[model samples]
Target chain A: MKAEKILEALGEIDEKFIEEAMNYNMKKKFNWKPIIAVAACAAFALAAIPVANHFANNDMVDGGTTAGTVAPVPGDEVDDDVDYVAYEYSVNKGEIIGNHVVELKVSKSRGRYVIKDKLDTQKTVYLNGMEWTAKYENSWSETDYKVIVDRYTGVCNGRNMSFGVNSITGKCEFFMFKTTGDIDKTVKLTRDELYEIAYDNFLSGGYTEDPENYQLSDECSNGSAGYWFKFTRFVDGIETSEHVRIGLRNNGDLYWFVGNRIGEMKDVDVSGFDMDKIYDAIEIKVKKIYGDAYVDFEREGAVLRKRTDGSYVFDYSGHIDVKNSYGKVVQERCFLIVIMD
Target chain B: MTDETILEMLFARSEESISAIDEKYGHKCRKMALGILGNEQDAEECVNDAYLGLWNAIPPERPSSLAAFLYGVLRKLSLKKYRANTAGKRCSYYSDALDEIESTFASAETVESALEGKYLVEAMREFILTLNEENRAVFLRRYWFMESCREIAAALGTSEKNVTVRLTRTREKLRKFLEERGVEI
Candidate 1:
């Protein structure tokens, strides 16, 4: 059982054994050429047909347009009560990139919306009256131009709300969507009261809270049945924002609506407010005034927190409050806002 | 070369088939058989039996991996020879090895029955693959080829006791792996 014996055995394969094995194999008979030929033909056909068709239909087609196109204009008249409007615009031939340019036409009649991005020279957009000033910036990589929309506030079912378009991504990011239908009549809850409700909810396991410890802010929202909350917490001296929205069904089933945004406020009137500029301006003002104090703000359902080191974090929830620059509560229910410094 | 090509050459009763198999896998198959059977004559006989089995099988069956198929045949032949030659010999090497593996395959009733069929071979292959390369090589050399603990130790550049410990742990792991994969062993 020594290593040398094993090595010797491994090295000493008998030639006679192989000869016998060969003889044994020679006596057996099987015909497999037909099966192999069929399989090979099938494999070849599968790999070729679709590829040839794709190459054959590579030609581009001209897309047709309908009627007059609306040009981009500042201070366009908008109805205050209206949810959305449609406008047509065209991207000139000089602005087209690569071998093709797709113009996405978006039209909204009432709250219903439709977006069509076809291979064409012209594009139309149906935007909400509140989001009329949303600007679009094209990028070399992505087909859609980055849209920057100003921020705005509204009340729904007693909750204050805000939303805006991302300056870089043209994506609509919500700030707050609190039910503000009866904001004037309902008694407003203070920050401390809101914190107690959240804490109690967590302790009783009645609310599903985030595992990460985030500092509570005024940014919150109220949805169809329940609410949403967002907080920013400092871990290892680094600030991180965590947002969660919980919906409580009548049968006591809890559903989570968590994302990076608080509400769909980016597609609304809040498009005029340049949140990035506002955040930068506030950070400067807070550092100058507060002098190293931990500064945070919440509006609609968006929360922004800044540590003494100047590192900031942004998060939103659909069931939170939106606050203004002066720390005054704007939305009564849940909505988020960007806080300073 | 493919199993089909080897089988076709084998079925044609070609001398080149023997030469081709030896050229492709003689060393590996012989080494594996030697590791389990221990005796050179027994291992050689197992390899010969494997070739005979392959010759008989190829008329109906075409293996995907000829080397694996040959190795399996040799292993079964060697194990069967070991059982027949050592029957009722309580103090023999075969008895000792069987005793060592008894606890793992206690429910199998017979060692040959336990080791037979595709399930056992597949389980062993999977278990061996999961082991660290060095440990797997040592285990294969010791158990499958019937090499001694000292041989495994020297080959792996470790102490005999370390080889024993590794073998024990690997056997336990193989046992667990097989059991988890729904094998009685």
Candidate 2:
């Protein structure tokens, strides 16, 4: 039989049973806190300077120490065209080109945002109380400078945690703690224990979800919001989509927490039908934005989200390879299907 | 009101059970209906029909999940309206949902079992259980909930593209699974 026949056969299954078994249920959410924060950091670093130069902030960190700020290297004023250079930490492994910033010497990235991908090791790396403006000189978008301490590596061993705000969306994504040891010090906390630690430490007062109707869904979120657990609460026997993610390390260390972040959107209004047009709009928008930077893409899936104004926003995702000016794949990622606002 | 509270009202045969279900899941059921029928009149009609369906079902079937029970009622009614009035011309997210997964069995040859709905459903259910947690979520979100990639992306906190890609692959896998099982599509 053909796929159409299979779907027709599928139609015979009572959608009601499917609804009860699946639709009315809630899937656990992944944490995008780290990636968004780090990507926002990369966005800031890219827009801030071209070659070796300071961010011009001389910003003092939480512990009263200055962040990495090197003196302007020779020929810094001459090369005003380069978009970005290497990172300071990536110089020794031949990761330097004209000696500017550090390039990530990624050994093997299993998964950050893609499906069915996992990092080889549970690693935890933190951006020590950094603030970035997620904007570029090529655009008019300039978010406010927000203090964000993003950790995207394995588990942590410290206890000092702080909060940061992501100006791009005007939401806080981090509740970080200081690292006192290595990954060995991290302890994997159970679901109940994680909740206990979170409630006793973080959500006792400010949590909006009524504790009465909630249950723990999963122990971990997505790759970006690393090493966190989820809680699902119900109202009137219906589980609301809202969920809370508390960031923890494998060693049961707590540094960050996020709440009421609904990852899946449902009950969308698909009132009209124009499948081909919708696909066309998405492809056009993608080409317009990425142009040559986007190498190629495999059409992933589509979803509908309800906007605040009560309309629907349709999106389609793809796994694409994006190359930089040097013909190097700067990003091999599952590019979120550009949203239709 | 909690579903338990509503269930209690339903069990007591309180007339307010109807209003309570409406008050809680009314808008949701309406949206579900609208997404299927794409007709306001039909969507509204489904809401009433769902209320009646619930009134009848609850005295005998105290569903553990009230939202599912209500959505099931509304969705079945809306689809009935869609197939009957629309000449089987589906034009809502439900059809798009079918489109998302249609690629899997596109290449398969039909078999005698394709006509057996119960057999195919059971095969589908068994296949669904074999999926990994992430894939299963995407499958249910698209096929069962008829949600868009954007919503699944939001729920998963990934890009909509990833959700789409995952679902697309899942359907392909499902097709292969069914084929391997001697179930032709």
Instruction: Give the distance in Å from residue A327's predicted Cα in candidate 2 to where it truly belongs.
Output: 63
Q: Write the per-residue lDDT of candidate 1 for residues A142-203, one digit (tens) a residue.
A: 11111222222233222333333322222333322212121111223333454466545544
Candidate 1 chain B weakest lDDT stretch, 10 residues: B108-117
- Chain B TM-score of candidate number 2: 0.88
Whole-model alpha-carbon lDDT for candidate 2: 0.48
In Å, residue A287's CA in model 1 sits off its true spot by 96
Segments in model 1 whose C-alpha atoms lie over 4 Å from true places = A1-341, B1-8, B22-42, B90-96, B103-134, B153-161, B174-185
Residue lDDT tens for model 2, A1-341: 24444544544444445543332212224233665655654543354354224323444322222333332231233222221111222112122111111122221121111111122222223232122211100000001111112222222222222222221222222222222222123333534565577656444633343555566654444332225556666778888877655555422346443333343334365556565777677667656545656566555566655534444456443455555433456333332323454
Error of 1 at B80 (Å): 1.8
Which candidate's DockQ is highest?
2
**Using alpha carbons, what is the TM-score of model 1?**
0.28
Tens-digit per-residue lDDT, B1-185, candidate 1: 33456678977877677666764566556665665555678778888788788778776777665665676677667766765665455433334455556544546443344444454545555555577655766665565555567745543435789878877887688667766865564
lDDT at A77 for candidate 2?
A: 39
